[model samples]
Target: MGDSIGFNVFSFFFLFFLTDIAGVSPAIAGTISLIAVLWDAITDPIIGFISDNLRSKYGRRRPMMIVSSVPYAVCTFLSKEIRNLFYPRNCLRI
Candidate 1:
């Protein structure tokens, strides 16, 4: 099982911080998260399938993992940009 307490605390704290402390609207947060979830749902399986089918001297998963590192990091860094676009700058902290 997962760490339920940690997950719950994180979820509560994050939503509270976003909606109350940070002044973000609930609808904006939900919309951005929904889009991110959908994007992950579509991309993750494709990435896993490609990785699993790959045949290389360096190894299948390892190669994909290595290649994906930069893009993943970049995406994480740029996620705020997409999120910021969904909400007014005065209403949220980027």
Candidate 2:
């Protein structure tokens, strides 16, 4: 649930950041976002396979989830902050 919520929030804000704040054209922004979605589609199953095969005392997903949480949160926060700071207001006009 948390992961889904985070992804939703990031997806909403990231599109605005690209189109409005970063002054990217809507078409290009859409293309870039499409590429990211495609990459996720390609990588997710491979990552799942690798993690499924991982053997450890802490178990496969648990250790990776724990290790990833901090970095993921930090990166998400920093990325949003950097974008906000760099573009105080929306730069692109419709």
Candidate 3:
């Protein structure tokens, strides 16, 4: 679905930006990303399972969706942009 595509695309660009543009070593970037992907793999299924079984009055997934939507979008944008704009080396050399 559309949401899945957004998540996939954002994750791909996040990894690419980290390794390629953010000046992180490729090995570290890959390892970090691999760990994140594995964590996502584990968490997504559990979240989906819970959402599928919920019987809340406000709707099973709506609350989570609402709570996560803004933060997810904001963090994705910041993740892509913030790293390039300010790095530890730049900060420390000031």
Candidate 4:
């Protein structure tokens, strides 16, 4: 749910923000967005397959959820941190 919302927000605002505010070229911004979208589309089905077939004691959903949370949180954090690191002047204090 949250991820879908984030993706929607990213698709809507992030290209403008990247090009206008962060000084990224439109081509680069588009590439970044395309890569993210493509990566999600590819990995989701693969992860779904792995999850459905897993025989863990904690069951498929719980184990996959736990395993995936680390990357989710890290990516969320790094998104902000990378912006701040490179474009501190443009970064808001959120």
Top candidate when judged by TM-score against the true structure: 2
lDDT of 2 by residue, 1-94 (tens): 9669977887888888788767799999999999999999999999899799988899999987988899998987886567456655664333
Give residue 30's error in model 2 in angstroms. 0.8
Give the per-residue Cα lDDT of candidate 3 at 69.
94
Find the number of clashing residue pairs for candidate 4: 0
Clashes of each: 0, 0, 0, 0
Question: What's the lDDT of the predicted structure labeled candidate 3?
Answer: 0.78
Q: Write the per-residue lDDT of candidate 3 for residues 1-94, one digit (tens) a residue.
A: 9769977787777667666666788899889889988998999999999889978889998988888999988987886557556765455331
Cα lDDT tens digits, model 4, 1-94, are 9769986776788888888877799899999989988999999999889889999889879987898899999988887577667755655653
Instruction: Give the distance in Å from residue 58's predicted Cα in candidate 2 to where it truly belongs.
Output: 1.1
The alpha-carbon lDDT assigned to residue 7 of candidate 3 equals: 76
Q: Which stretches of candidate 3 lie over 4 Å from their true place?
A: 1-9, 83-94
lDDT of 4 at 43: 94
Candidates in order, TM-scores: namely 0.56, 0.76, 0.66, 0.73
Q: Output the TM-score of candidate 4.
A: 0.73
Q: What shift in Å separates residue 51 of candidate 4 from its native position after superposition?
A: 0.8
Cα displacement (Å) at residue 40, model 3: 0.7
Cα lDDT, model 1, residue 85:
65
